[model samples]
Target: MADTLQREHAGVIPGSRAAVSAAVDHLLERQDARGWWSGELETNVTMTSEHVLLLAFLGLPHDDIRDGAIRHLLGCQREDGSWGLYHDAPADLSTTIEAYVALRVLGLDGARPELSQARRAILEQGGVAHARVFTKIWLALFGAYPWEGVPSMPPELVWLPPRVPLNLYDFACWARGTIAPLLIVISRRPCRPLPFSLAELVLPGTEWRLRRVEASGPFAWADHLQKQYERLRIHPGRSAARRRLVKWIRARQEADGSWGGIQPPWVYSLIALHLEGMPLDHEVMRRGLTGLDRFAVEDDGGWRLQACMSPVWDTALAILALRRAGMPAHATPLRRAVEWLVDEQIVGGGDWQVRCAPGTEGGGWAFEFDNDIYPDVDDTAVVVLALLEAEQTDEVRNAVARAQRWVAAMRSSDGAWAAFDRDNVRQVVYSLPFADFGAMLDPPSEDVTAHAIEMFSALGVRPDAPLLAPAIAYLRGAQAPEGSWFGRWGVNHVYGTWCVVSALAPLHIDDRAVSCALAWTERVQNHDGGWGETCASYRDPSFAGVGSSTASQTAWAMLTLQAGGVGDGVAASSGARHLIDRQSAGTWEEPEHTGTGFPGDFYINYHLYRHVFPLMALARYASTDA
Candidate 1:
């Protein structure tokens, strides 16, 4: 394989082995004493700002936290005086609105220069009237936006069955968790007093109405009708529905006191429960608020909040990267990581079981420390692959068996996989007026399916196995004419192409598809001998595989080239050299948001991506026979 590919390109870059060793040391040094690895999961300023807002809504004394968050928000402001969804992106109206309001709530006067600039930017973007629905809801909580203008999500939505259209289950798990609590918030329409009015933030003559994104003719009308229904004071099933929603929300709270193990749902759940008369001192609210302390990260710069944590996901990937870098299963770090992962495996029922095949034994892993209710297939598949490289003791073997069975049973009707749910492909949820936030459906995505395929292949499943055949066809059909598969979870084409190519590499099938994808990866290689893609690619494909080179994305392309059996090829060598040249004291520094939450709407800078991925790429290069 190397001989043919070597002739097609060039040889591997020098110093790869030393670079791998340094990266290995860097990663191992960061491993927790508890036998796991995690990095700060950074989103945008919205997270920190929302933390302040949540604290304020609960009337909790948060002087210290508020001071830190204010500093963090100030630091995050761009030259034009706006906060964005990701680093170096254009100013987002909603993000700026939230940050500006958070600063106000934190005691920063509107006359402060930073707040003034942010105010100017908000006005330039059409002010509060143009912000997203969620942002408006946050404003409504403080009487800054009108509750009548916000989209309606009746708690009665819980009454709908799974078989019904536009039911609660139709929304993606993240969205579902958020919407469930939001139902109570909307119905209650609780408004706390703001010390200062946001009159300066709202555009004059603009009414508090839905923007284009929030208005979908019929859905908008339905929202209006729902408001009318509320005004009429109809009391049919309101109490019953609120009880069910409260029960639903409470049942899903993780051990860490977060609902769905995410910030949006967690914060909203606290507010919803509080509005429903749950006191802050109550166990549920106390745990919920106390758990948030874990998500808050304070550094020399300031304090910021992670949108979510990723221990299992990071540990699994760290294990894979170490194993690829020649760390034996017997090595202390590897052994400890494997043990932590085994202990972390969720063996109980979760929301995934709702749509999962009946009798699918429970054994999956979530990204967070306690998100047992939502163990995603992506993490589960990665965990299974990592465990395969371990010592495989009886415990490991049994855990892997159950996980593999759960994964197999979770396969979608089309024989592919989604991140969270199985066969969760309902599109009607997207048509709802309130669904403009982000993706509402957890449909099968190419990157996730690729991971599933790769996991099964690692377990000795043949390329032609009946179980994998349909999945292979799914990937083939999912390929774009230009040869890149869409990355549903990562940044863009580079991530998806890497996933598909690497997954199919061991199978030695799809030669033509692989060739086309290989050409695409090489064609997109940056002049710096690396690869990158902007979050904008999620909005427009022309930006795919095009941006300033980053450690993580460059690693994705390098791994793709190597996986296509061209580890010695010119493109692979260039990418390897790029990684080596960019290496610092031990690891690489990446500020780009390489991970996707809701694509264009939200992005993540998985702080560990800058470390683990580059090491994995460099190690594979050092070990390649080329």
Candidate 2:
């Protein structure tokens, strides 16, 4: 078995022990003194629930914080007694099942009425058979599902050439990192049955085979190619594949025991190692356990998943927003945040290079570790805006100038600004099955472009500035025929339209464009005084102007109107009132996850965004007559 594994990955260079040790050291050093490790900004109930599961597995007491989290979990349950990706999202069977399992582990009895409520929700939503592909894999590990139900994941595929049509590299970087260790586990197929059965929760007449086929369609080509190269259910070749996969996993394990500074891969890697007979005392196991500490954050309200780090992205934006909202440039909070931002700037390359390519020579910072591969225009632009808002000390001035030059260099030929690079013009790759992301292929989004325009315009780059014409053209082209623009990084059309109006406000673009955008926004304003659009908006333009009213969406709408000089005091004040009314004591209430930068497919509710934006909107509206 070991021999076959070695042959399968013969070309792979397993990391030297010395190199792995150094990587682990680097990861550990990055941990905050508070004994928590959090960098990946995962935005789902699964993240926080998993954190609780991990802590419980590590023997942490179920304290008040755990209770609070449990309550938070309970609060999100749908009428059907299930949970989903976001608060207001329709209940997803997969997330509901996982949350139910986690709650049961926390001492909730499945036979209890509340537990039965969740079980019933799961059953009604098509039960385990209807859950996601990953959920099935997890269930298989616990003998809740048959191993054969899962699609075969041959470890030998790791040796395929990068140029191969369905090679691992074809996957998004995050997907590849996660699927690596997962392949190892799938190859092993360890099943430890729970004491009870979930058969009662399974839907009537549901066929797991059909469910499997449906879920694999997005990556069916890769699965098919992998199967064609390797036979299934053959034990003779399995040992070698397992050993080779273990070696591959070991090589990529970051210094702190994380696979790639992300949770999905890190958790899978730890589980894989555990299955390999690596005891809890093993240095690898210890490192994996300790690595989770980096992600733990504790505040007065209790602990929650960070979704990811915010130093470069959050601090920069916070500084800039405060300045824009009239906070003094030299205020202590602004200065401290700026100092953190300036220090956090990446001076070298990062993983973004994989997408943008090396030698593109752009500038900006990423939101995570060793993320120097590409400097995002959004982060860079925000940093420039922040630095410009800081007191113009010689050091601050120098940093501002450097960031400005970098932003200028990253401008696309279309005269717009993309998130990471200037001319990443590979559209063909985006059509691949694995590219589930909506904006993964684009050069620039309206949200990011508008941000760039605002920054450049403020930097004294006028409407006639060389970079301005193409940007304006891109903005005009991006506007929907219905007059609204799509927001790639915010809620939906309202966010996009608001961003365009704000960007055009300083330029004093003719009222024709402004009126068009403003009219679209006013049209979409819900009777509830907030605005929202579902993830469906991304796929169907008809749904773009339609979503439930949400606090964050309301704030976005109000901010847009205020920034556009719309001067509808009644509307602005009413919207602000709605937002204020939604506040839970002063903190904005969590309304469905409106903060998602990626909707439907990948939902996120920035914990801070729920409060900060509404605060900004209310403060601004209250001060203005409008």
Candidate 3:
């Protein structure tokens, strides 16, 4: 099997030189003089539509950006008159409803054929009454649905201690931050009505109704009991609880006025503050609005808002790609990138400390430019790996050591690292009716574990390091029966398998595991000389490693093949050709959002992935040990 693989990739390098040089030169042009790269992080129209809604709700005057954003939403509408959550995703009920409302609010006549078609599509999907919880909450705010129809998130629940089952601290940082503000919105049941009704989305006689509750057993009982308790507390019997909840939410606000560095929490927090009687011009409220505004970008293509900004994450990944393409780490461009990364390291307490064991100064990187309250293990690992490959200066030395300590302390009892919290494994959080966006708990994942191991290896930690064996055991367990691993943050098995192979190759782990994994990835290669896995793979394993070829997934598969020692021959060359064939003027065209925000709920197109990953692949092919 190994011999066949080797022969297939033989002499692939020389064929890729021109493509490699083009890709590398293109990427070098993208770097900042001070050393960073940020491409737009694109999401579905829901993000842009929702931003319009937030701005309107705040009574902010509609500006040209909003006008451009309106055009973006209209442009993205499917020919069938519905909207989807991701590219090629079937028309989603929640997204269509949101986009339709935002358009209506922005002066698109509800009587227009475009609006009528969307309304029909939404009604066919069971109307706003059956949309996702988040969408339902938005409807309730607009007075389209009664607050009683939505799930109760009583403010008093914030009073629950950490030891309790449903404490806020038990939620992932994103969940807790977003929900804290939502609880305030739900508690007050604000009925801010829109100028016109969206009666078109409803069927002939549909009425607002609360979701039914039916559960058995103790776990189920606790869930129903919460709803029953919701009815008993008319205004959440405790004013102290409200005060503490508000204080808790406000204290975590980033310097930019976002809570936990994301849009949902910021938008919700702004609404919650207004309801709580903070004046519109209040400093905190003003900052939050500015922070959200900063996320918007308008161009000739139209306007869109990143669900979240990712300069720190994108910069690190870009550095790795450029270095792999034969740029010396000591070069000024690369060194500047390293210096910028060291400056972004987290040096103070964040929400992670609420669950983390004490006694370590905080040291890691957050995904956004200004989110200090949350720094993720995955971003930290990526940055550390990139720095190790760069010219190791004094700043890099201090940053890496601090990250190593924080990472070491964050390792779960199972020996793997989760993206956010330590020991945050409560299954009940996900089963909660209000908790359906997928990542309720921050349990360790195979891909995150692989990156941690690779980071350790890059830092020259011994193979005998305490975290190594447990993480290796984790990889062994996560490997598919057919030998692939599941990627939590990337697309699917291809991304996961690549992470494992990258870790094992450098560390010289047992060959059997690596070989089986390599063969599994190779077998799934598309006829186009690439790999493709739909996000549907999350709910159905049969779709795992199956889909139309994508530039990012193809590069990942190529990277895995090279790591397995076929050494950039036929298979690698073919993958490079797919990238080169698809790229125009140095940029690769990829419509599919390859980065996973949440498996079923959200997905992302890291616009840079197409260019960066292919460059990484072709560069390795051009520099193989053949």
Candidate 4:
């Protein structure tokens, strides 16, 4: 493998056994003594800002969190005076509107220079009147934006059956949990007056009747239809619909008193409980607040909140990286980590069971703690894949079997695997005026499908297995014209190509598409000998595999080339050198948010990826022949 390849492209390579060993040691140090690694899950300012708004909604007094949140928001504001979903991106209207309102709630006067600048930016960006549905609802709660400004989401949506299109189950678990509570909030639009109003933030002469200008696509009129439907709530069974919706909402709350571990659901659930007449001291309310507070992280720079937790998910990935780096499966830390994962399996029913075939045993994992009610296919597959790399005790094998069964059962009719539920491909839901965020449905994505396929392949599932055919077709059909696949969960084409090509390696497949993908990877190598794809790639495919080289993405490129059995040794060696040279004190400097939380809407900085991925890439290099 290396002889002819190394001769084709000569260059210095930095990867070594020592570098791999040091990387493995650093990862081990981060793991808890009991076994599990959890790095800080970082998000944008909106999380902390929403934290303040949630506190205000509950009538909580001023506290240091409020002060620290404001500081964090201020620190994140660009010179143009608006907050982007991620740092260094352009200003986003919804985020800026929410942050401005949060600052006002925290006592920033209208006369403050920063406030004035933010207000100017808001007006420049069309002001609060033009913000998204959720932002308008937040402002409406304060009697700042009118209730009529936001789209009406009737609680009656709760009545829709699972078999129907646009039903509650059609949405992903996060969106489902977040939107159901808003049904009550929308039913009886509660107002919590602030000492100040956003009068100065509103654009002059802007009408309170917000138009759905941004809503466009097939069923664009779904916006008008939704509003008309809201008016129909005045008919005979309206009260029944409302009550049933509340019952459904209350029933779905997780054991931790959260609807889901994510911030949107946690905050909205609290507001929904309040609207249901639950006092702040009520057990549900108290537990919900405790769960919310647990997500907060305060540093000397300031306070911020994670949108969700990912310890289990992080630990699983870390184990795989360690194993690839030559860490024995029976290593003490690896054994402990696998034990923790086995214990975390969802052994009972969840929202997934509503559509799952009867007798399909319950077993999967979620992205966060205690989110047992909604174990996602992505986490479950990754956990299974990691366990396959570990010593397969009976417990591990049983865990894998249940999870594999669940994934196969959850497979969409298109033969693709989605992150959340099965058969959840509802396109009409995307045309709603309230669904302006473009994440209305959890459709099958390449990265997710690739993970599952790789899991089957790694487990020695036969090439002729029933699962391989549709998946191969899906991957072939999903390949980009530029010869890459869109990475739904990671950065961009590089990550997707890596997953797809690697998974296909374990099975005999048409080599043409795989070759094209490898060629693209070869052409995109950075001048510094690594690979990178900007976060912007989520928006513009032109930027795919284009940006400052990073450790994780470089690893993806290296592994993909190595797995595809293409690319000269020079490309592989140079990529390895980049990762090795970048390593310092057993860690890589990666402040970039490499993880994707919500494709284009949100991004995450998973602090563990930099170390884990580089080690995996280098380890592959060490084991391969030249």
Candidate 5:
């Protein structure tokens, strides 16, 4: 594999395994005491800035982690003094408005020149009126915005049936878990308006009424349900219902105190509970707070919210990468990671089985800790792929076979695999009033399907098997006209194209389809030899193939090219050199976080991705013949 490829390129080529090992050691030192890693989970300026405020609210001194955060924020500010979804991205009114408010909470007064400049920027951007629906609702709670003008959220609707078209179960689990408590708070309509008018901070003549949506009137079935429930004021069995809801919420809260396994709504739910007079010392509050702390990864630099825990996910990927790098399957780090992956599997039935039964007992793993309600095929597939490379002790082989069976059961009728659910065919779930957020329902996405295909291939499952044909057809059908694939989990086209091409390589796919996909990737290669896609690509497909080069996406591209057995002398050597040149002083410099399981509205740049991927790509390329 190595002799046939050309080697000359621009980037520094890592000289030896010793250097790579040292680089890995340096990164391992940066891991938190808890055996996990995390970096920034990017959001709009307001959310990022408010995140800093939350740190302050939690008692970190201004000088603590504030300086770096402020620098990051300042770097991202628009020329108009407002902020946006990302640095170098266009100005977003809602994010800017929220960020402006957050800066005030951080003790920046409008009279201060820098603060004044930001205020002017916010006012020019249409102030709170142009902000997102969630931001306005937050303001209304603090009386900074009018409660009456905000949309209604009646708690009585909790009693709606799961089978009902508009009931809570129809919501994406993340949405349902987050919004359930928010409904309680919104129904109470608590108001503690700020002391000063925000007129100076808003655009002139901006009417609050213009931003308001009526609590009544039918649109979706959910909206009609909202109207019906609004008329009820309170449920006839209100006390019993409240107790049941609280018990249900508490029951689902992971060992770390979060519901639905992530940060955004967990924090919001905690605040809502706090506002409802749940004492900080109370068991529920304590559990939730401690859970937040558990997710917190600290360093001398500061702390970050892991969008979710990644031990099971990271360990699984690390094991696979090590095996691919030609490390012995029983290497100590590989063994430990394999053991962790095995232990993380869920034994009982979860929410996913409501659609298809994941046949094996102790079927698969979820992405977070203690989340037994859902076991995602994506994580499960990846875990199985990793275990397949481990030392085949009787226990290990059996575990791998069991995981394979579980993934087999998770295959959708159409041959694709969803993240958490099976055949989640209801697109209408996304049209609900609260569905303004990204990806509420778990439909089988392209990336997850690709992953499942790869896993089955690794397990030596024949292409003619019942499960393989549908998935292959789906993958081929899902390919875009330009040869790119739409990535639902990562950035738009680049990530999807990479995974699809790599997965298809192991299958006996049409050579034309494979070559076209490879050609598309080669065409989109950044001048820097990496690949990137902005989150906007999710909203507008035109932006799909564009963004700054990133380490993880670059690695994905390299892996795909290598797997497809395409990219002869010039392209292969060029891509490999690009990665080598980016390595700094024998270590790879981490770029802006780029591993995203969700794009645009939600972003996550897994910290480990920066280290693990570059190493895998460079090592694999170095060992290959050019």
Candidate 6:
């Protein structure tokens, strides 16, 4: 392969083979002693701000921690004196309010230049009165915002069975974990008095009123009734609900002290337990509070918290990239990674079992190191594929078989797979007043379904396999008119199209659709021989596959073209050139966020993307240079 590539295009890119070698060495060097890989999961300043507030709410001292986070927050503020959900995004009212409040809590003077500028940005964006429901709830904690102005998620939701319309399981697992605890906080209405006031956040004439209702009339009316119910202190089933909720929250806390292995649930659950008289010195609270240190990264740049960690996801992807780059399966890093991943498999039950097929024994991987109850189909499928590269052991084989069954059983009714739930396409949940953040339901997405299909194909599952055919149909039905697919977990159309095409290309399924997608990839290629898409594409279809060139999206585009059997085509070759030209020592520098947490609400810059993906694209392109 190296000889053929050299004879054909060495002049066009003399460093192609060298680039692949450098990237491989770089990835090998990145392996941790434990055989896992983790890149910094960077979101906006809201995570850091929330961390500070969480410690404060618990009456925990954050002296130096507070100063470091304040530095990080101030550094992240835009020239407009506001924070955004993603880099270079328009100022988001909720994010600005949260950061401003965090700065205040960290003891920055409201009259300081930074705070004054932020206050102006807040008022310009409709002031604190227009913040999201979640933001308002945070303010209400410190007696800044009125409780009546925030939406009510009554604790009574705990009693609803799975079969009921608004049952606890109806919400996505993350939402379920968060809402269960938040219900306790709302009912308790616990307030921790702040040293100062937020009177400056309210515009001169603006009063606390329900911002323009984002939910349906009926849902809004239901929330109003709940508020009135709270006013009357009417509670027939409140005690039973609270007990169930507390028990439920206590049962799900991971060993690392986080709830659901994410920030929202972790912070909120601690507060809820504290409100219910769980002592700070108790083992659970102590572990939960201190476990947050694992998520914090402090340095010259100051401190920031990850919204969630991604070691399992990062390790699987890194191993797969090495294998794709033609690394031997017996290579030391690959062997260690496979063994570690095999051990990381969750054999215990989780919330997913509620909606999964009957008798679906747990054998899947969670995205985090310790989240046993939330193993996702996406991570499990990818891990299975990576494990196949290594010589299978009895333990590896057993883990694989169990994972296959779990993935198969996780199929939603639409013949597709969601990240954490089966058939979790509850639309009514989005109509609730509290559902302001982007995605409340974990509906089946094309990207995850594609991964599942690819895994089955590698296992030689027949085309007519029960899950295979319907999953293919699901992808077919999901393709946009312009031929791209919607990326649920990644950035946008480019990521989704690459995943689907990469899966279908080997099966020779829907040749016309594949060709159409290939054309779309080519059409969206930037003038500079790469591809990019803004996170805005999630809310605005017109922005699909449109943005400044970045290594990750370019690699996704290159892979899509190669999957369509056009690795030598102009678009693919140029994308390869783009990666080769931009390489330095083995990795590209990517500051842009290419990962999605929630479509319009949260975004992530997986620091490893600049390394793993470009290498995968360049190596595969070189060996398969038709």
In the order shown, the candidates' Cα RMSDs to the true structure are 2.4, 14.1, 2.6, 2.9, 4.0, 2.4
lDDT of 5: 0.66
Best prediction by lDDT: 1
Query: What is the descending TM-score order?
Result: 1, 6, 3, 4, 5, 2
Q: Tell me the tens digit of each residue's lDDT in model 3 across 251-328.
A: 988887777777888888889888888888999898888887778888876888888888898899888988888888
**How well does each candidate superpose onto the true structure, as a TM-score?**
0.97, 0.77, 0.95, 0.94, 0.88, 0.97
TM-score, prediction 4 = 0.94
Per-residue lDDT of model 6, residues 294-343, tens digit only: 99998887999998899999999999899988988888888889889998
Mark the regions of model 6 whose C-alpha exceeds 4 Å error after superposition: 1-12, 208-216
Clashes of each: 1, 23, 2, 4, 15, 0
- For 271-377, candidate 2 gives per-residue lDDT tens digits of 77777777778888788777776676555434555544545665565554455456688766667666666665665554344434346444566555534533577
- Over 524-577, each residue of candidate 1 has an lDDT whose tens digit, in order, gives 999888898999998888998889999999999988988888877777877887
How good is model 6 by TM-score? 0.97
Model 2: per-residue Cα lDDT at residue 555: 74
Worst 10 residues of 5 by lDDT: 3-12
- lDDT-sorted candidate list, best first: 1, 6, 3, 4, 5, 2
Cα lDDT, all candidates: 0.88, 0.64, 0.82, 0.81, 0.66, 0.88
User: Ten-residue segment with the worst summed lDDT in candidate 2?
Assistant: 11-20
For model 3, the stretches where C-alpha displacement exceeds 4 angstroms are: 1-8, 12-15, 204-237
- As a whole number from 0 to 100, the lDDT of residue 295 in candidate 6 is 95
lDDT accuracy of residue 478 in candidate 1: 94
